[model samples]
Target chain A: MKNAKLRLETCLSPAMYSKHANDDNIVVVVDILRATSTICTALHNGVKRIIPVSTVEEAKAKKDEGYIVASERDGYVLDFADFGNSPFNFTADKVKDKEIVYSTTNGTRCIHMAAHSKAVVVGSFLNLTALANWLIGQDSPVLIFCASWKDRFSLEDTVFAGALAEKLLASGKFETICDAVTASLDLWSLASPDLNGYIQKAAQKGRLAAKGLDDCIEFCHQPDFTSVIPVFADGDLVPVS
Target chain B: MKNAKLRLETCLSPAMYSKHANDDNIVVVVDILRATSTICTALHNGVKRIIPVSTVEEAKAKKDEGYIVASERDGYVLDFADFGNSPFNFTADKVKDKEIVYSTTNGTRCIHMAAHSKAVVVGSFLNLTALANWLIGQDSPVLIFCASWKDRFSLEDTVFAGALAEKLLASGKFETICDAVTASLDLWSLASPDLNGYIQKAAQKGRLAAKGLDDCIEFCHQPDFTSVIPVFADGDLVPVS
Candidate 1:
């Protein structure tokens, strides 16, 4: 490592996007609570493709094209949404061989922000090792942009970013790192093995669990449960086959 | 601890000021490399006051009022400046009972940005214990805004913030914390008992060392070297008597 050839940086929240989050870097957007976890789980179970639209209107627009609309607002299913963004709803029996047009309050917006990156990939604890393996094979710099709860720093999303940052740092593939990335790595190290307990007690857990999706918290914590990598390109998330 | 009554947040770089950096929070501006360290050192040696002006013109303007002008640009003393920002120059013999008006490339600018806060205080490794004690006595939310190198995050300022954050988190005064503060705490824990060695390998060390200020780095690394707290009020940095 030339200590400068490859660098790792993290945006603790997409709302904190500075010019440093340029299009030149490979962006791994992490929304561990549900969105990315759900997408990865759906893809691992043989979902055809996912349209990560920015708005519920856009997702519903894709509904006429035989895409199952999945949307959530404030952690609940929207009025007309077929399914809320929860991994519990993304089972192999239901979503296999189907298309999903998904939109959420925060995750979808973050995914749209990644449209200008060199490449956009979804990551969560559910596919931690799988995404880390894929990211390690890339030549470009990496940016982990956390889709925090409505731009406020959520504990779960940051811990997820920290987990990925730890993997990237340990690979010794990068020479330079920003403070946020370093902090994430330290946080991950501080809360290992008990990651589920950490998420269960996260400040955001009250708001999420209050929404009656406590199971989503548990479901998202299963690390490396799937080998599928859901990549965003051409405005849709497709398995990197 | 109400856990929500007092919150701690950190801006890794002054340039990364987000809307979450509320003006209502008590801002503790940290520049541990040499600026805050020098201020603590000078005040400890019985300096009357420090005027941390943002512009060279403002500092020069204060010169007419019999205040000693100290300024630095690009890690070296400006040609006409009375002194550069270095702890080596702030000794009891040279600065005792004197009024110093100082400006630096990055630290002073960060101090000026603290004007909107409920109160602004300077923090460094030198006054770490004293500053933490004072802040723990406060009831308001705290923000540790690190004055990094220019607009980017520097390794030194953040480490100082991390040190303070760890203290604050342990004090049981805070009810909530953002990821930045948590990360800083972890960083501080990871570098304990060897802060000097950590500073020696910092990314910013190369630039300062190249300027022949290696002695200054060593001086700033000495934790608890001072008991004075420099508070920014009415546009000047005055010792909190």
Candidate 2:
């Protein structure tokens, strides 16, 4: 039987997914801005574990238990937190063998919204190829849930979703049901073979540049910075072992 | 001072204006899937007037006053209505001096959402060049709100938005603020001078083909079918005149 997988790329917000809660499929939550990038970097640097809580209070509670607290809000690190959203904050020596409690503005909320999904995988550009391969192997429909900024669609996240969808279609692993998904694939195809340049010159990156955050944009655009697949299991973002 | 006018090709939703709702701007709503297309056809063909109500009941209530209820739900024409959503249904001879009470799944809702905008124009491929020229002459930010399928993103609508945005950029009339909109412009640039073929082979059109609705897609893709600009004002759709 052909796998009847449904892929949804959504920005992380309660408003985006609340309507589709009854959907029975795997939801891949993506927050490419800095959350997923930060998580991928931390894990690749040998962070033993990450407990992704939904609130700053929960992060603090976990910190009281002696875990390193990594939290961000409004694109900046909380004053008392040990880490901010920048991928550069997580280095190999700093995170090796250390468990951390983490939270973020949009990505964590997305994981919570997809808590009822059959499987929820944390996705970002860093592991795009691996996630695409894993989605093809799945027996269920795939939902590329983009954690869009707040509840609105983010260009980078949607493009990332489109890029993944394009890969899946090129691999001939699944069929697309939505025009948005297919159009996204078309957009990706047009930008393919030079996706990094595409990202650097994109509107979101430009905005960050105007705000003097080009470093963060460059860090997020780095491809295959890690091979770790972060899966939201039992309310925690653990590396796919 | 540089004219910081934003163009439609780069962004295609109300979300793009979320950060600048109070900014002086003109928004054009596009829904090629029958609403804007139908409206353009109706006005061009001699429909004396068109009242775009928000709900089926509102359309019926207007119909009770002897207006022709041309309503669509779920992309299908409701029974007991004088017309469905087909632009062909609104030819000059048929709609001459007629008052149409129209309601649709998406387009009208977008009109309502943009009711407070400085100016709201209905756009489609049917009037692509004319709309682009008009946008260039305006000083306010131009927002192309794609009346996506039932509030979800739709490729056909966004692509049309992208095309309009591309035209504005080429005319040197607007600056893009949002990343998604800029990406859309880039996507449009890559696929330009061949949009007709692009839309025909797009995923949405593919789905329509699967359902044997290729005729509708072909009809919707017809360019410059009408030169009239349909503007939403005073709770009705009328020619810009």
Candidate 3:
């Protein structure tokens, strides 16, 4: 692989996270419905720094320190937390200049799992191009690690990964895509034309819509909606300038 | 789920297998390139039973009991085995009227892991309609478990699963489809017209071509190439007559 060209590959779920040789590659964890997407939107909305924690206990600890703890389980806001893991609450009126301790059912766990990678980035349709452009300038392979719906393959995350992959592929910087990457790229192409119709019927659709989080879905579904490239560095999520 | 309609979901790899609640569902294990495809071809050629084992040692134990042992690793046929796990070798002249024991790098392990399920069936593009028709006849939910290339997602298996899912959905037997299923179904629709063109660039392509197993690729790519339905029953693979 030393002599090979730069590549774009996707790990569909955290379960397949171990299958990737991501030690040398940049990983973009995509949890489009909606943790990663929410983080991206929040960063774009000027939240100071987002700390993605693994457990509710970890989130609560930071809450005691004055950080607003946002925790979600099964697509609803935790009774003890300040907010849900939805981007609707990430508007400037709410989270501007604030530090958020975020914990979600699936997405935060994915962020922690990829903490040791060369670099971990949060991806969504919100910041799709920004994420892709940053990766194109890198010299190593790029692994789009989709933080699927609870270790199960989720369409929204895969679609976001596919969007980033498509952007990178169009730039002609990463051409050596694996089969899974190809499949996702194809899926993104198919879904791009009518994304709302496609994602509204997604696997993770009911969990949020049932909780009246359709606003979160519409917020995250906007293509190239935000330019905030939220990168996980030194255990915190910060915008990459 | 009794009052609700039967759903069809797909697990793209064994990595995603644990994500499935398949205890009540019938899992159709698919490994188009080529374990499931090969097993379907073999059963079509009148192979009485296919004992899918997880290890070379287990395959050899079956060999000692007069089973025609087939083993493959890294796309190569083991010296002690009668043949490699390729559909091209499952011609009528070789496997007809035989009871075979098979073990491959990824697919067999998936079969063994899913043994405790209510019932497991082998699926491939070759028996796409047959597999879908059988599922439509049943009332239970169906899980298309793709035996991905070593716990990682593979395009061929996913495409096969999508094709079957497409068929099932069209029959109106399965209305509740998950995110992965929708992705695969869309992928299948996109790749259906030029499947060979799509699969030839699959992740497993170079590995098999490097090992001179390109014949396996051509054989497995044929859509609805055969009508045999190989179902895992009584701990063995047998054709559904």
Best by TM-score: 3
In the range A1-115, model 1's lDDT, one tens digit per residue, is: 4555677887766656664578788888888877888889889988899878777677777776667888887776877778888888888888898888878767778877777
* Per-structure clash totals for the candidates: 1, 16, 0
- CAPRI quality of model 3: medium
TM-score of 3: 0.93
Q: Considering DockQ, which of the candidate structures 2 and 3 is the better prediction for this target?
A: 3
lDDT tens digits by residue: candidate 2, B58-167: 87788778888887665566675787777877877778988888888677777887788888889988888888888788777777777765445666777677778778
Candidates' TM-scores?
Answer: 0.86, 0.90, 0.93
* Tens digit of per-residue lDDT, candidate 1, span B1-241: 4355588888766546664567778888887777888888888888888877777787778877777888887777877778888877777888888888888756777777777888889999899999999999988888888887656556678778778887887888775546566556656777776877756657567777788776778778778988899998787788886
- Residue B146 lDDT in model 2? 76
Candidate 1 colliding pairs? B3-B175
What is the Cα-based lDDT of residue B2 in candidate 2? 75
User: After aligning candidate 3 to the native by TM-score, how far in Å is the CA of A9 from where it should be?
Assistant: 1.3
lDDT values, one for every candidate: 0.78, 0.72, 0.81
lDDT string, candidate 2, A113-186, tens digits: 77888888878888888888787777566777777665655667767778777777776656665655765666
Ranking by TM-score: 3, 2, 1
Q: Cα lDDT for residue B194, model 2?
A: 72
- Least accurate stretch of 10 residues (summed lDDT) in model 3 chain A? A1-10
